[model samples]
Target: MSVDVYLGLSAIDSRRAVPRATKCHVHLAAKPFVVVGYHLPGDPGAPIGLLCGTRRERPSTIVVGEPREAKLRLARLANFAMDLNGYAAQFMQTPTTSRRALHTHRPANGPQLVVANQATAQWLCDVMGRRLRYLRPDGDRPVHPGLPVAGAHLSFFAGQRVPGSSLVLPLTEILAQHWVTGQLPSLDANLASQLAWITDPGAVAEAEDALPAGPVPDPEWETREFSDAIKAYHQLVDAHPTRADQPMTGTIHDALRPSWDACWQALDLLHSLPPADRARDRWTQDVYQWSRHAERVRSGQAYFRKRPKQLQVFRYLTRLERLTADLSREMALDDPLIMAGHVAAGEALSGEVVTLDLSGRRPSLQVRPHLPFPRPVGTDLFWHLPRSTSPSGPAWPIVRLTTIGVTPEGLITLDVTAGAVRRDRHDRLPQPGQQVVFSPFGPRDYHPDTLPAELPWTHAEDDDE
Candidate 1:
């Protein structure tokens, strides 16, 4: 079992969540846009309400009195989308010397969506984005102009779900990385339950009275309150064509208030934790991706086909693998405690250097792994160079892991090969007694079979729109 999981299991005796991470791995934006949204459970694609804003005290709320009514749904989303799109719009104003410079002189970190979990993201992205983005302004079922823009942006945020992208951060996932609760992985997805265990042991993890943090309401509540509210809304609207409809919207908003409050409380909890060193690096990638997407939108080329072709899928899969590896390498290098997990797994080791031979054609070291696991000769490994002045910052570098000699006691002498030592100008090789760690970083050590440029007939691309 992984160290984090082990720690979580051990935490059961304590009756509280165990903090696996001292620093927050996810990027915490300066002004993260908190979003707590709900949609109809029966018809998941339809949004019922959305509460979003930057401030803690005041949040802008939007509710659709009738989820089935397309125009009303689109109308409610128009202002909400404007609010969401408005978050990104601020960063777009800062002009660049070149159509680059990461979009401006300042860091172009877009609006970070502090949400309950991936389920909430899907409600906003898959359900909302897919529904609205393709709706033509002049179609048979015309939509407000902002709805499509909102849909496209929402889809973009969802697409940023690739590893290391901080645009749409599900708080549950982030909280899991930092603190491991005693509950099952499935239960961890619930923000209120997770926070309950994290905040205070005496606090109830699951209360009978407390509402579930959701994009979907509980069946009991829907039957008891939600259904009645929707029916009342329809009757009131039918009675008066132009009467104020705030009462109807207010009813739905009140039901979702608990979840909305939980999302904000979750953010406040995250804000209390310190950020990881490599978090900035990951956030940089997010800003760059945001800039590129913004430029595409500005160029009027912001369109994602309902069905993407083969090449697109292949490229996306390839990028996902690459970025996932990058995140792992970054995390290992960024956190020593995290690296210790690698040590336990036998993928890496840490100990004082027994012998150092920088004088050789290839710089080398011989040190027994702190936790020795039997391995065959010539296993390729990487030297994790920590806190190096290089831009990569604490890189997992080096070339080969050549087992030069072995003894009957199971001790091994690993001869480091060429291209191993990559350091800043002032950074020299480790001395005879310095501690170090090594691991097989996928991108560095294992060269997976390269993808062919020409596609097979089955996976071939087409000019499908």
Candidate 2:
């Protein structure tokens, strides 16, 4: 009995604006028709399916039961193949055509190619090898008619093709083993380039270990460092060269590139900063003199002259103040002025009877008089009382210290209310029901006694006072 396979390509869904097309290749014999959704049927007609190029529209189905069914299936297959070939030609000619055009044209008596059964498909593969090409309707092009289409039944051939044994291996395990053992040449040069950009040495090592040993070209780690590595990583992501959307190497590169660049920038910034105060002092002095001169002009009688120039001077002063503030904060120093070389000028007045030495290092006294008191080593905790609740209603000194504590465990305990007090030890932490005041560093126990019942200082009743 002669057996014929009828292949029809059609879209998977009917509702899409353009349906997604797939190819169903069905085999038929003279007897009853049988279709196998999972396994290849033993009977006359069994559909060994292979999806053709993806389409934006639904594809027509092929029926292969009786003579009429076979003729109809053959005709549909022939039309589909011819339409696919024509679509491929059009796509090659004008690449920018709308996806709707993918299935717009139908061919007359579409071409038919005959194969006996699944074995014939494999035999054809062996005979044609890489030379085999199929008219892919959905892709709108010709593609290698290998396992993706021909012998797609290999996935179904699992248990039936193998000799009867008590144990049955899964198709995935068999394919994985074949992939590991198979001597396929290294990936194409373009693919290799993509791997180089996206795959790290560590990931490459893992992939290599999973597969059978092969010639792994050295990963040029040295040459790829610094700027080149960043550029290559970005290129890999942009091109998306992998057949699989979520290739392991692509994932590794995506994660590593940004983190590596950030580390590089951080290192560069650290290297830019001075290692010692001596180096910092030189930069500070130049900045300080520029700032002071600008400040003097703004405060003096010359402030009103050259208003535009004064604005510029004020801007410069603002920048200098910010720089000085940043340096002081970073260095954890009381005063940045000590590094501004102001101390050196005071030494020259040593011989004078009324010599004034401004050499002593001190915290900025702009807001208060310099008091001869021991400096505190910890944070000066304070709070900004909301204006509405304050005695004077919206006034200064609304800022006041709510509590004081040692530097190390400053907020181990707090008295938040007029009479209530809460205590916390390293071992005995406060629970949810207990009111707690949270510090920027972490949570703290709120002591009710510490909190003032109301504003401590009352506002004067009259505005004249």
Candidate 3:
């Protein structure tokens, strides 16, 4: 945690309330396509209901009148699948030439899928992918072509929920990242509690306002109100098979509506903050990835894998670690508040230049700051030059730490080695009174280098048996 976050938490404790950050630090391409619903608790493979849409008022809600019928449940799911697929299809339908690669085709943009929490996203992807991926349109019990297509698309998005992509977002996770609540992280997982802490502290004190956002409802509510509603709907279906199942849909809608509204409200909060510079860059990469998956689907090669091969698993883990570090550095460089944490942790430091020895054989300088300094001499650092000429231009100039000592007035002195600057580029160099920030990340790219086009025989396991 940064000193700012520490100080903010202390203030929150004193005031008994959490506060918003100065700006949003997350990248959001557009209003999120929000999804809120519950699945059968005991039957993991069966979904009880789902309410989802791009807009809050226009969401389509589906509840199974008979959850026991596997085909019936899957048919209802197929409807939702088609709807989600249709929404996502807009991004995949059109192809444009890649700006970075002349001969390659890329999508204009990608769809963003938002869920109540991380578990809901994982559940939606894993369970639905298994149920629908292999369904055949020409088989005896034929399924719609859209069902498998949707399954592949949804599975692709769920996999995209890893560190760098903004395609699949969890509302609670994003909110907690930008704000620290007075309560524990466990409590923050509850959307209602987190929103209460953020918008109205008094709401947390009342039971009525803090409703559960769930794939599982509260046992008390489930045992009484929700149970009664389901029973009544079944009774109506039994008495008049022609009548609609409004009662079941209504109850599930009421249960999910608060979180539905909360997801949009949280979007507004996250939207207020300016996006990090690399956020859009990462999203563009997501578009490229999505387009590739869509191409596989179009080519009749989109079979969802239940388990990745050993080589693929190794590659995935390695990529996840690298992406996590890349995201951290991006977030820190984008927001000063986030960088402050690194400063507190001694991973970075910020100060004003004190002395410049530009005439020396190896040009160097000294810096003085009021903050604590813990690094030994000879450590390397990068300075974020404030006079960056373009929005996409490189801002960090690399420098090495050379010396550390206390002066007569008890002030810390940091000496740094640097290369000679061009006379015309004097404006880019840090002058003695200018405040500067330094950290480990600089102009170097951390993205994994592209591997060879051909797969090695070692990675292709034998299936001769």
lDDT top scorer = 1
What's the TM-score of each model vs. the native? 0.86, 0.15, 0.88
Write the residue-wise lDDT of candidate 2 on 260-358 in tens digits: 232222223223333433223333332233233234323432121212343444454555555454433322221222211111322100010111112
Candidate 1 positional error at 22, Å: 2.9
Better of 1 and 2 by TM-score: 1
Which pairs clash inside model 1? Answer: 398-420
lDDT of each: 0.73, 0.25, 0.71
lDDT of 3 at 80: 90
Residue-wise lDDT of candidate 1 within 1-465, one digit each (tens)?
889778888778788888776666778787988888778887877777877888767788888888888778778888897887888787664332343354224374566877888888877777778877887788687777777887888888878888888888888888887788888889888787788888876775344246766788778877887777777777778777454356656766787677778777777777787777767767766777777778877777778788876777887898888788888887776677777788788777566667766665566667755777555677766664443456553343345556666657545667656445443321345566677676665333445647677788776656583
Model 2 C-alpha RMSD vs. true structure (Å) is 34.1
Q: Stretches of candidate 2 above 4 Å error? A: 1-51, 56-60, 65-70, 90-465
**Number of the predicted model whose TM-score against the real structure is largest:** 3
Angstrom error at residue 394, model 2: 79
Model 3 Cα lDDT, one tens digit per residue, 64-130: 7666778878778877987888788777654534646521332336788888888778777767766
**Candidate 2 CA-lDDT value:** 0.25
